[model samples]
Target: MDRLIVMKTFVTVAKSSSFSAAARELAISGSLVSRHVADLERQVGVRLVNRTARSVSLTDAGTRYADFARRILSEIDEEDTALSESRDRPEGTLSVICPKWIGTLDLGDAIAAFVKAHPLITMRFELGGMSDRNYDFLERGYDVAFHTRDLRDSNVLVRRVSELPFVLVAAADYVRRHGAPTTTAELAEHQCILHPNDPVWRLGAGAETSHHKVQHPSVVANSYLVIEKLVEQGAGIALIPRRPAVERLASGDLVEVLPQHQPPARALYAVHGPGGHTPERVRIFLDFMTVWFRSRPAAHAA
Candidate 1:
């Protein structure tokens, strides 16, 4: 078997996690796909995939090899493109991944506008589907990943894109009925809405900061947008990202609780594999996103 072909096939199988799916993607037979993987495994003298009757998953060796293979293949493709055309202009496909909530808001608009402006670059914006595992995007064929929290990985270049400020808000009707919580300590007694990741709401800045463990949550949700809706209907108090909550707060559909307690703005980051060999399109896209987000109305607390 050709080494390049085997490498490509193995990478496809690793990504799809199924022989049949990889075959379909490659427009080949499942047995042929299996043979390529087996040949590659024999060449490497390691079992790349741990195959069972029901499922196929990469082994520890397979996991590391997949990363190398993806980078090698990507570099090869880039070189091929470079040889045929001038590498001065950014071209080729750039894949990005972000959380589902960001995709539905202004972030989505920013991405769309970016793609529209960069006609040469093909955009593959994957909305959500990030696993709980660390830096899963690298093995999953993504060029870049966006995250709100600071990533601890040393292998990737992390850039602070923008500040995602959030406000703890509730509906006027609910505030009237439940009475407002005047301080962070008082929030413990109120019917708070919990963000699955941020169960403990940290409020205020610097030395004045306080952490309030969400107590008596009437609802728990993963999406901030969904939390905003629940808060609007007088469900419970929620900490909502300012961009999505601005209009509602302005219209009085929601009222900020304890406006004095300004929570530190959540840092939104653009993270990707180490920058040295990173493709030009990926770099440009990240820069574009940062500038676009910075221009938007920030800190929507009135």
Candidate 2:
């Protein structure tokens, strides 16, 4: 028999002081209750109960053991209740990891909002240093990880928060000065601002999509914010995530180069460990971010 089962049965019997009463309370047979007490006493190597024709009582050792067992069981119940209640309240440290580019973008604002909204949840947001393996973050003690692409790993649970659209944009002045490229091939004739990390520029969508390798560029930078600034200065045409480019596009500082063709949109995903019970902190954070993304004007436009 399981120790806890025998312990619980013995505790019930000790409280009621009758095998039949404990059996009735536990909804088990009287013989099973007697067997449990016998098993528990044998496990402890001591006599825990004395039975007479009319009544039942505990020995001196049984009295002390029962007291300890009662305390142990009570503490366990208290801890269990506290844990169950905590699942609803969502109070704990939530570790999250994501790519540097995505983190550097507008995700930080959502995170800041979440921190302010949920003061009880401590945040450990790490930018960059992510492994290609999706489930690696779980091994590194991360409660959640953000991905901009579809994840094929079966070991993690994936939640699609939003779609991040991309636009091939150029400053209005640059378009006027040099003339906009009508085709992907024409990009080679123009000075194109390129991010060194992702040199291959993608254009169009689905099966119609064309990938252009940017060999010669007027400017190269790791940061998209820097690239955006350079593009605003009429440096060159660059592909930018629509969220950051929305205001500039609206203000007419930037205009689309290839308006007919659309770039493939990347889905923003929040991934956590594969399990039925997701930690409350992770669930709330994901939910807050989903709401935050949906509330954004850029998301609506996307």
Candidate 3:
């Protein structure tokens, strides 16, 4: 007996709960389905199912065996499909995860374009709750992830895809009401709008980098989108990524403060699992991202 066929028969029987129904689905006679189940039970040395005059139900042991069988069958199917995909064409689900701030601000257009270009690839781009732990994506079953922070892990492959320049900005009203700071130290004296991840703002460039704690933040949130809104509403001053705020900055709704003391550009990296036979989907996406970002103006991002 082919073990895989037997397992599939057993799984079908377990799902349908009746041999006749299983046989109908598998395009076989009910007796064959029964024989398959009996063979599986005999091989396992356990009574796999309990039968009544009118109905059939799985026993305790049968329930466990059915679950195991389903998992084995699923894994086999996936492996077979993956092998086929490698020989044929790029077609599979590509799961991605990214920080919500980046997703909303800068990554949206690229995602749209990737999806549009690759009709064979189904994308599941989940935003928010990305882990700080290295290779957490492997555990979470993600194909790729976008990260901005400096990673210490050498185990995961990272490609620097883009750089985002951050600007210190506040509404004209906020600046008028609260006055602008000439130095980083004065930010402590003013109410700041801060993201929880980088609440301690690192101001200035290179050796001039000075950390200013959000001593008295009028608004505190984990999202840059929200923090930027608060700043635009004249709630407080904030260091926000400039791309999203460009229109407001031009309209004079927001103004760049401390222009000489700009923060370091945030590095956006495309992260994936360590060396292996990289999947065609992953390979294609990385290439697409590299091209997409390379075409983007660095001065605008910087």
Candidate 4:
């Protein structure tokens, strides 16, 4: 009764020119094969076969229909094979999104390396413009979204990519002018540049951890790069991700404040839609990013 089954039976019968042969080839009963051809003919409103005492042959309409059917079946097979291969092979366009700052630094380098290694995979990497709502990336058609914070969404899936280190930095000029805070309590007296979303800086690790809320913010900006620049200009002390600040720290442009007390590291996460089977492209990319961050743990130290 299924159209594809009937089409297949008719196609086989057309090739063999015998219902018995088609039944034998398809491993069905001869009557079923005859019924399949009859159903197909009735659907098309045309007699598709001519039977003689010794042989069977296709009618004029049957010959044309046979050709179309064969082509359609062939295309269907090709499409099925392609889809199956895509599930196993990493050979498709992978759309990914992340925060603007992370996408521009070490994470960007990892993605670039992945692109070079897997020539079959086409990647679309976007920076910034991430929504506060966690699952928004899935609706926007992104295959993966990177996050610096932990996400607890039932509609989405998450993997721990790496732990990102946060460093409290101030310019050499600022340190000379205000003097560095030797203890956690002294930080209250210093001018701080704060990200509105991250007003409290969690210092230390484990039980020794302490939270310091920004008491006097000289400048408030959402962009970490802008905050880094402001910190370099001696505007105020700020806590920032260490990856982008690596070069500046090495060049002595920025100095760490309260060397004994470092801010707690945050986990970097890769978020995707909830599914038991992750696409090969997205899976491979997530694996690569995890390794990339793991290899650069030194840069993550505050």
Candidate 5:
């Protein structure tokens, strides 16, 4: 089998996690798919797939190789598209991945505008969990990712889109019942809703920084939306991004606590995989999003 065909087969099988499914998608026989994968594994001198009667899973090495294979295939597609399309018109699928809460709010509007402007280009938007790492985007064929955390990956291009302000807030009822904290020390007395990753809240005022480990949380969750909902229902206090909590805060459903001390703002980044050539469509979309975010009231305030 050709190396390219073998690579494609391996990638398909890895993605679908079943040789039969890959074969069906590729219009090839299951045995042929298996043989191609086996040949590729033998040539590479590594076991790519762990096969069982019930299911199949990729080995650690297989997962890494799959990432490489997908990139290679994407590059090939880009090259073919560039050679075929006119320079004036940019067209192709632009897949993006972003945290659920952010995507559900303003990011969705950004994408909608991009699509409206460039009807020739298609898009795939994935709403992922908060803790999802950058590599997961590359592995899943995402051309771009909207991430709030600082990333250390040199393989991707990271561009700052905007700074997001995080504020500690609670339901007005909860604040009235439990009494709003006037100082950092008072935070310990409140039934805080904790972000699992940020167990120790970092409260900042001017040049001063204070870290407090929340002793007891009425609710702890990985999702910002969940935390906001809990806080809105007066279940507990939570730290949330300004955009998601804005409506609640305005409606008095949630009130800012210790307004003088806020959590350090996090920068939102637009990240792309390493390919010497980034698509013109991808570039345009990213640029538009950056400008759109900057013009937004929430980002401007931050």
Candidate 6:
């Protein structure tokens, strides 16, 4: 018996819970399905299913094996689909979700270029706010999600594409008026724009790492863009990523404070749904995003 065919038959039986149903679904004889199950049970040396006149249920070990078998079969299907789609025409709508700041910066441009290159592909980019949940993207029908924070779920596939540098910045006027802090100890004296719960700032010095407790700002905003604007308008000093603050720094609208003690970089990751049964379009989009971000300086620059 072919191993793939046996696995498929097992999965079908497990899902339908009846040999007749499995046989009908696979368009094979019920006796053949029963024989396959018997062969699989013999190979494993255990009874997988308990069948009676009234009901058919999986045994404890059978339940676990069924889960694994389902995942294996799904992966095989996904791999086959990916290989087939690679040779065929690539045409599909690619949906993406990303944090607000990064999307506004270089990521937006890269996506635009991707769309231009693949005229047949349609793209939908959703900007995530502070309250947006990453997993909600799956429910909202997004194909991929870009995130900068650590994920808790082990099921999702996460790939670190690049690192983004963050810096403590303030408008020149604000710094001059408030006086620059020469030491981390003096950071508490100034009005800081806090990112709500993110209070610890990692200041880097050569091989050493130093953490500073930033002084809470007089005002707190959930949006990073709002924080950047507040700092740009000389509201207060804010810890912001390098890319979004680049133009302001060059134009002298915002100045990097204590550049030598800049914080450790944050990782930008491309997260996707589980690959066990992922679609070909989603896999292709994820591959493209990884390659696209890796080659861009804006995602890695300090």
Ordered by TM-score, highest first, the candidates read 2, 4, 3, 1, 5, 6
Measured against the true structure, the TM-scores of the candidates, in listed sequence, are 0.69, 0.90, 0.70, 0.85, 0.67, 0.64
Worst 10 residues of 6 by lDDT: 128-137
Model 2 lDDT tens row, 28-89: 99999999999999999999999997768999989998999899989999999999888767
Query: For residues 73-112, what per-residue lDDT tens digits would candidate 3 score against the true structure?
Result: 9998999997877634667889999989889876888889
Give lDDT tens digits, candidate 6, residues 132-229: 56577777787788888887776577778777778889999898799788877788888888876467777876776778876566677766778888
Clash count for candidate 3 is 0
Worst 10 residues of 4 by lDDT: 293-302
Any idea how many clashes model 2 has?
A: 0
Worst 10 residues of 5 by lDDT: 82-91
Selected candidate, larger lDDT, 1 vs 4: 4
- Report lDDT per candidate: 0.85, 0.89, 0.86, 0.88, 0.84, 0.80
How large is the C-alpha RMSD of every model relative to the true structure?
16.6, 2.3, 11.6, 3.0, 16.7, 11.8
Stretches of candidate 3 off by over 4 Å are 1-84, 152-154
* lDDT (tens digit, per residue) of candidate 4 on 54-169: 66799999999999999999999999998988888988899999998677657878888899999999899999889999999999999999998888999999999888788999
Q: lDDT: which candidate is best?
A: 2
lDDT of 3: 0.86
Among these predicted structures, which one has the highest TM-score? Answer: 2
TM-score of 2: 0.90
Q: How far off is residue 179 in model 2, in Å?
A: 2.6
Models ranked on lDDT: 2, 4, 3, 1, 5, 6
